[model samples]
Target chain A: MAGKDDDVKVLGVVVSPFAIRVRIALNIKGVSYEYVEEDIFNKSELLLTSNPVHKKVPVLIHGGKPISESLVIVQYVDEVWAAAPSVLPADPYDRAVARFWAAYVDNNVSTVLYTVLAMAMSPKLFDEQLLMFPGMAGVLFAATEEERAAKAEETLAALAQLEKAFAECAGGKAFFGGDSIGYVDLALGSNLHWFEALRRLFGVALLDAGKTPLLAAWAKRFVEAEAAKGVVPDAGVAVELGKKLQARAAAASTAA
Target chain B: MAGKDDDVKVLGVVVSPFAIRVRIALNIKGVSYEYVEEDIFNKSELLLTSNPVHKKVPVLIHGGKPISESLVIVQYVDEVWAAAPSVLPADPYDRAVARFWAAYVDNNVSTVLYTVLAMAMSPKLFDEQLLMFPGMAGVLFAATEEERAAKAEETLAALAQLEKAFAECAGGKAFFGGDSIGYVDLALGSNLHWFEALRRLFGVALLDAGKTPLLAAWAKRFVEAEAAKGVVPDAGVAVELGKKLQARAAAASTAA
Candidate 1:
């Protein structure tokens, strides 16, 4: 096992909201780490070896041992740092609630949004490939125009649920857990930048201010927060990247 | 908010492995609690109000405040009890690993098994109804005989992964997290009761001793462990319940 003095490195991609989760966690905990960008389309050798299971981004390598899965990494950061502004609540019940919602964000918000984006950018990939995989596969498939519209409507419904949660969970606080941004906040907030880009790229409105005022405000506060400002990828960069991926996917399908 | 002195009530079903999770948690913690079995077909007002989102069983009512989701409830029990034998490891990486596997068990093992079971008992429920829902819905679906057999093969493959995990993660320990049964253990262990019934009901072996000796051994040890005694529902009971549910579902479908 590597010693305590060993390095801390994060393998990530700017477009991936999951990677942003780790970046935000590290930033909030005030822990310094090397952030290495990975080409998700063609994963690096290090990423492949580091996270052999998912082979996905947001792998945090601390002292040579890599930890994958964004929430798992976030929890690890909170525990290892063991500092103030704890990511999860000190109370067990509170922590349970926090964990539930974070899982909810992953299940309801993140995965669904990714499916929607995949449908828009790479419909063939969405229907023929990604849908067949296990766990949240092809959940929001859009094989037809009507199907696409239905999925878009579903996204709005999902956002409405989150908006309801913000009203109920926040209870007059600025953040979900009160005072400062906590676990659920980071879990959801970290994805907002990339989600914003998706919104613009797809010409869809998910979290409309009129529909979800609280969530709209919360997203603004989260992205603009001092800790998150420099860490999160800019929306413009995200939009450009999305367009590039779209063009490339189209070309790949055409060539095939 | 209810005070600390309020009653601890667990709303669960006798056959649900998730309810077993809460039972094991409370049993391990040595916390006194009342168990209220819910009629899932007609959820109680209390259960519905407690967990308005899922309306599922395994709702932990502590001091009248309800906490839904089994894993969340288990974590809460470990934290509130906060005594000897920590539910997860102290090391951040270890905890992350445990969390990941626990999530994996939920994502892969539990969901897949439930889908298979639903397919067997109520094909209509599994197809038209469950398929319509979002988030972990219609995943692991098998409409035809060939599809079901393939899914069974997939289940075996999933168990093999768990067996591999036991070897890699445990490093010759009796449990996943080491000396005592930890978070991941409970995450998978609690399901053994329901799984046992499924094995007998479906006439398939997921944790075959010849194939996954480690997992097979772990299942025996988990069910027979003194802490798990009486907390986990009996396989006999589960089988009976499964049969009754299948009959009822068949009758309902015929009526429709």
Candidate 2:
């Protein structure tokens, strides 16, 4: 924790998609700032003071004022740097759709893909140490194979909604928010790397070419062009972390 | 369904708080618009086309483009009519907090208040007909009185978060957004009427002075000042509708 002499600074963790969202927006807007990495287990005083309520990552400190929540930070970046490629659309109606899809990404796409299966199948791990993420734990209590299978179907349904949204809203465009990778793109794109890693680890087939063609294609473009251009954290490192966690969950289950 | 000749038109149902949010924003911005009520039981073709993904109401049609989601519409109205008293704050950080609070109103205040507890406490009626509201039915299956009590306590906890938010963000202001009712006000204030009705019908003291004095005062101010001033649907009518539905839910529970 130090004085806010820096013009712009981001307080975040590496593995978090939410933090990555801020990083992507700041990069897209071409705003230069200092990046301070935080150990999520031991959150810094700066993060705590800046975001007392949430007490989480992706707090963008600009000219001494801190803005919390990833999407909010993205919108702040968009508004403050209005000249930079117009992250949100100029038209009011298009802006609404952009906002809607961005929210959809947050609520449906990212949350469901990352959190739901873990919460369903290996909830005990979450119950032990996931106090900060209250909602993510104890949702389904799917202990049995049949129960987990049913919960997996629900995750598919969630992804299916996103696929439908992509097809309907995008309407053959390069990005959901149109030609540029704007708000919706960044919101969902931050998690694409993790999702892909999960798909490889768990064989979930969330972005299965047969089921979600449009989304699969979008994911391909997002990873190859948008995310690989940098700012997104290493996918391999995250997946390794996830594997270790899954192994622990499995070990916990067997011991029980 | 008519063509896009109308300057502004809102496709919404009166009983919906989301619809009431758009109504309040448009009124605050001094924009005149035609209102079309949609039957929730049987949605119109226009509603389907306008909000294809959600198939929900409060879709604002300006010129030819239709903007879905109530908060999104409110933002659109705020952006387009930039001259009219900035619904969101002028400062970027303040704007982010406002946006975050507005979303909190949606995700926590409204959903946890009306749907989550009812769906958790009562199950049969939702099983019969609440297909569109997938999340509202059969969650937790808290059929026992003790379970219901626990869930109710959780609801109060959620409300307490909002109370904390109000106190921290408002900082002695009448509304969360500022002196006048703005984005956060409309977002949370739209449901104040419904909460009041629930308090009366169910005898639950949600806005008790002892626990949530700021929110209690805020609710009173919102109802008497912002909501009762013509744009919001009559609270009495909404309460009556809610009563009838509650009666049905009671009946369904007994039958089950």
Candidate 3:
């Protein structure tokens, strides 16, 4: 067991939004921790040992015991330092709603964002690969030109729902939970940075300022917020990295 | 706004484990709620209007306002009651761990269980469908002789991780949280009835009592616990339903 007296430590890759989630949460709560950047391509022994199961970055170590998973770490940090700026709702029901949306973003929105980015950056290769995958391939790489058009319609429908959810949740508020950013905001806000970069790169807006004004405003406010100012990665860097990742994925598809 | 004095009502389908999650949480909290079983085939106007977005069941209506999603509802029930049998841990870190596992089950295990059951009941049809959804299809269709011989190694490897997680979290305890059942148990225990039936139906023994004695014991102890007795659906009924659902799914695949 890690001793309580030892300094808190966070292990993460520099550019991952997942890692940013923990950093934002910890910073908001005013908890100071040592940040150890890991090269995911060549993982350090400490990172590997700390999160042996997932072998993923964004491992939080307090004392010596480690906790993996960004959302899990956020909840752990909230509990361990309850007196500070609370991230979760004090009421259980509200907390559940907060958690539910957070989970929804992780499961649904993330995948959509990934697919959209893949399609935008390398339309030809993405289409070819989609024909190979079973479930999503049909929808992602429709056989007939008509089928492709229909699939795009379906994709838009799903995106619209997500945009609506953001509007309803963040209506007239600086954050999802209202004026002060909460866990839900931190979770959702981290993704928005990447989406903003993707939108810039792709030149097709999913979360238009006009269509989802609240979400757009919330993103701006969140990025400008005191807690987020210095911690979040630069949008330009993320866009450049996303383009490289997309190009690499396209290359891999061609090779296969 | 609905007054606090009005009776709480839950709109959901009768046999859904998701709906039962809310029921169990509410019952444990000793909160009185009117159960309105919805015909999923013919969703009510209230159900449609209240949960306009998802239009799903297990909508918790309090003071006229509706809250959707079972996990979200459970949290709402916990908040409204705020006393009696507490479903979540008092400490935030432990509560986060419970939520993490619960979310894991919601996002992954439940989907896997569904896929496994679909495969067991209709191997041929499932194989054909697997051709369409390659990523997950490999696991489902691998039950066949030629495929099983090739894929069983990977399947077992994945299952082992789940077994290890269960052992680490719930071993030597009546439930995952020690002494008594908590959120993890309730979130997970509701699904055990379905899995138990699947075990008898498939006869493959995924939850081998010898291999995962703690999980087996926890399942037994959980379903028998006072919180679970009235809340969970009958195992016998679940077995019958499982057979029918499998048959229907198989037939549907054949028709397609």
Candidate 4:
């Protein structure tokens, strides 16, 4: 049997915001674990077996038992490492609010932003297989520049809503969890690099300082947190990765 | 300020599986609350204010504070009413597994199943405004019988995966929570009536006795539970509602 320390393993890709979420939570909880980088294009057998349903990365294998999904993994980490600082709020209502926003981040904000990023980077990636989320394609992806611009507008609207949520949740605090980073913080914060990458490379401003001042300020503070040190990737690195992936996708399309 | 019992109120529509999930949880916890059935077509001011983000059904209001989303509400109910028979598994690993399955139910099984039902009943609902889920249109909805059959096949495949999960989670127990209804049970169980309605009216067998025996059997046991008595609406009534909505949709389309 593996020891307590060695038993914890995270199967993830460094570039993925979902994978980074698990790392951030583990870092905050002060839990050390082995990180196995998966080739997302050609997934590892371990990852495939670990998450047969989704076959996605960021599977936290604890005591030989695999737990998939970033949010679920974060909560699992918080629960198992009970001694560490809590990821979710101690209060039930507050926890629910956190859960709600985290879900909003996933369903409304992150998916739209990421889909738009994918569209911007590699239009070829919009093919059937790459668009894993079926229903969101219409609302998210665009064929023409006009439609893409409209989608970007929708992204801004979502960010504006998140800005409001942050105001309510933060209640005049540094982080969404007040002094320290909490569930909602990690949920949106994990994608900070992607937001930066979008703005720098594509001129797509998701977290605008002028529009969503609180969230914009929150993003700056979030990246500087001790737990965020190595977990959150550089915006430059993200842009490079996006370019590499887009080239590969383009090549694949040409070959086909 | 409202008293303990009176403070709790649910803003929901009767036919929505999502709303039914909240009622089931509250019922299981033995918490008393006033149920406000919202007209989904013309959402009330309270419903709009309560759930401005989603503007959907199943908002749990406790002491003037509102929490939206069915799964989030179930967890909130479990946390706040900690003394009551736990809705989620006591073990964190078990809890994570349950959460994963519940998410799968929402993403994979329920959405596909429900969307197909909507397509079958009201084809006109496929219009831009009603097709709220844009990308999913390609994979989920079908204008032709052949395409719809393929989508149904996909739903069945998803169910097969859930069947495997049930075997792992149940481990010869009656419920997903092991001898009692837990989070996953409620998550999937809320759609029992709809599943039945689909099967009876459209011959869309989602939870077939032959294919997924365990889940089919589990559905029976789920509806029989005391918590499911009033919460799980009648399959016949669901069929009637589907017919009424279909007629209305057809009329609107013709009029347009």
Candidate 5:
């Protein structure tokens, strides 16, 4: 096993959800590492050099070799520090389920969040922004129109599944996985902020407290946890950013 | 490790890229199992009962628990028969990189292939199809237009990295990681058949012999190998299917 102080550094942007997922995972495991903030507008030399292929942030550099991709990085961190609180489930079936949902959240919810963010930031591209939803909706729901409408009728079905899984795993505990927060929580929690922000920005709610009470409560509980408390963006700030993004979207559309 | 059995059943459609990936992996490892062909048009009750969440094929039923998803099924197979040729590398870092690429291929390449398949199947929906290309191109190249163009100019640069990795690992051998094909090769090799079909379907090509000589050669070498020979689709059949898919795409677009 690599030593604790083997120059473990994370290159990331403060506002990035991808970066935050890694940060939360590392924090929960109590792994000590240096954090290097990268400016997306003007990426650092290290960021570019480290992740030459992707050249994106949230590159975890250990000893010299850099690992890119947020989900991949999380798995690497878990495997490298196996003795620490394991992020993945021990059983193969359970682990596969975890991965399936993680991939689902990444492909579906994350894409939706990006669409919402881009729309909020630049509403002038409303038609273009609307296209993003169909892909996401296709994944969340079934491919057919009836299936999509059914899924919309039960809007929070996917989120509800996560909440049930969380409750079962949490067992009345604070975190998603018993005592400490696990990988699933970390991935889902960051999206909670975006969901809240999107609701305010669009004035169309997706995950309501009534519809998905468990998930809504879990989101609140996750954010309020000690590990995540100060790290997350507040609802007010998120709303303000959401409004700014919407205004920008409108302006861009008008200009176009 | 679970005992090997002739009774081991795999429910999958031969044409499915995801199913074929697992099929190739199983054949590579010399794992014996019964293959149950699935009809995607009208899914069997067993598939629905087995994978209620996804309701997709490539479901490997061993003893009882059905494993869905090609990658997950690959891992499960590897775990069950510990003595069989290991698909994953033993070293943590190498394994991480291999896993990273496998996940990358699963997430990105698979999606691109779908879009490409869609485009080939229906030329009339070309405009709708083109919309999907930007995201795929962005990942393959760079984010911005200028950067993306530069990246395309250096397309072989990324392919070179893959080629070098394969060559070094294979050591002038047929398989990726030596005498027997390993996980990385299976993850990559599965795509070769589809690429071959696509080349014939569409006159324009991506993985040319001149541009990616090693990879192009590897594709031919892989299909001819004893392990991969049985599973690869015949050229005649693929062409017919491609034409049918293209016809379907045209009809759907016309209706739209």
Candidate 6:
């Protein structure tokens, strides 16, 4: 239960990995908050007012003040709830390494997912509107299955890099932060369901055991972790959603 | 005056704003270190060894441990120094706000500069290679003066958003972190010279007094700050460099 003064609310969408990251961080910290699922298309006034700059979800409204961006929110959670079980590592160097990997995951791995997911989630917008925004078009648009496959290869390459990063950061431990689920784990793990969904949709094995053995094992442990309970979506649901969106996009394209 | 155990070295290029960020942060903290300017075209083994993943600079090597990425290095500086003159805000919410804006500058603002700069700095790479990287192409490849002008308008708009952010964060103070320079200041201020060069090269006033008055004033003050003495470059040198690069690119195109 949230206290009167320490009220926390999360403006998010169920399928968003970014939103899921905030939930996982809050869940790990054991900080209770009200979750308000947003219609990303027709965003709420609160979401708009809260995150005016980005106007996107996973906004953590703590004590009436809104903090947008999932990574920023997770760090905010770590700082505000400064007790045991810290999300980031305690040492300065370790902390920097965690931040580096977290960012790398966002820039390299997450962008690929967003490209495909953006198409799946908002096919009409992907087809019609994204053309206007060239920068976003590069990020969110994949014209063909060929392009998607190429992007998938990039994702695999990124995962391989993360595999080495995990070996270095984890150092024969369970997770990137070592012995416990930490910032890097949360950053990459939140997208595990989507990674699975991508595999189901396009036959792209992002976390292939053959390629990234450590990361593949880490993924399994991460999804099974107590903090991930109810926070991470089931892969099947994500796949079904992807299929539905794909069908809609095909119909829209045909009409156009 | 560096001690044996606490040796610090920065592998960077003079023109890089990202590298300059590390210098500014280190200079402010009064940390004495070696500056190894890397030839980005023919990157040294040391630079490659230090930051094998990205292999780009502003790689801060502390006591033989290497940390890549400018923002990450700055944070590491703050954490390790742990003095009164902190780069990041001590308050959790304020820190979150600062980090959000810093990232906003990197994602929204620095990107435009990088696009223009990449073309100016590496004309051969731009002409020969960048076509294959479509994602980078959208960000870096602007064929005409028209596209560059459009990007300039986008930069001006970003500056306007940042002007409001400064008002909120500074609350009538000198810098984004308050009276003293902080994280957001270093993040954005590091690019002041490059911004000037962009203006000189394209006749686009990014920090137009008419549009973003507060930011224009902030930029002036930031450049004059004591910590920025030798860290920030002279706009004349950057402008000259841009001109030279432009000429070479034009000559290369004509010959082709």
> In order, what fnat does every candidate score?
0.70, 0.72, 0.37, 0.74, 0.23, 0.67
**Candidate rank order under lDDT:** 6, 4, 1, 2, 3, 5
Residue A104 C-alpha lDDT in model 1: 73
Write the residue-wise lDDT of candidate 2 on B1-256 in tens digits: 1332248999987767888888878777777789999876577999989887777778998986789878888888898888877789898778888988887667555652244223344465343333222111111223454644554565567678878888877889988877888788888777766666656655555567888888888877877774337655565766676656555555665676
Each model's iRMS = 3.8, 7.1, 4.8, 3.8, 2.7, 5.1
Residue B249 in model 2: lDDT: 57
- TM-score of chain A, cand. 3: 0.79
**Tens-digit lDDT track for model 5 on B121-184?**
3454443443334322323213245744543344335555567667756678766656667777
Top-down TM-score ranking: 4, 6, 1, 5, 2, 3
Q: Give each model a TM-score.
A: 0.85, 0.80, 0.79, 0.88, 0.80, 0.88
Model 2 ranges with Cα > 4 A deviation: A1-5, A112-173, A210-214, A224-228, A244-256, B1-6, B112-164, B226-228, B233-256
* Prediction 6 TM-score vs. true: 0.88
- What docking grade does candidate 2 earn? acceptable
Residue range A17-130, candidate 1, lDDT tens digits:
787878887777777789899876677999989987667778999988899888888888888877546878788777888888887777666663354334444555444343
Per-candidate DockQ versus the true complex? Answer: 0.47, 0.43, 0.32, 0.53, 0.35, 0.47
The per-residue C-alpha lDDT of model 5 at residue A197 equals 61
Please write out the lDDT profile of model 5 over residues A127-172, one tens digit for every residue. 3433334323332313345654543444356676666666766678
Which regions of candidate 3 fall more than 4 Å away from where they truly are? A1-6, A91-93, A112-171, A251-256, B1-6, B112-159, B239-256
Fill in the DockQ of model 2.
0.43
Provide the DockQ value for model 6. 0.47
Using DockQ as the measure, the top candidate is 4
> Which candidate, 1 or 3, would have the higher TM-score against the true structure?
1
Counted clashes in each candidate structure:
0, 0, 5, 6, 11, 0
lDDT of 6 at B45: 98
Candidate 5 ranges with C-alpha deviation above 4 Å: A112-130, A133-155, A164-179, A236-256, B2-7, B112-130, B133-161, B164-179
Q: What's the CA error at residue B159 for candidate 4, in Å?
A: 1.0
TM-score of 5: 0.80
Runs with alpha carbons beyond 4 Å of true place in candidate 1:
A1-6, A112-141, A240-256, B1-6, B112-141, B240-256
Q: Candidate 6, residues B2-72: lDDT per residue as tens digits?
A: 36326899998787788988998988888888999987667899998999887788899999999988899
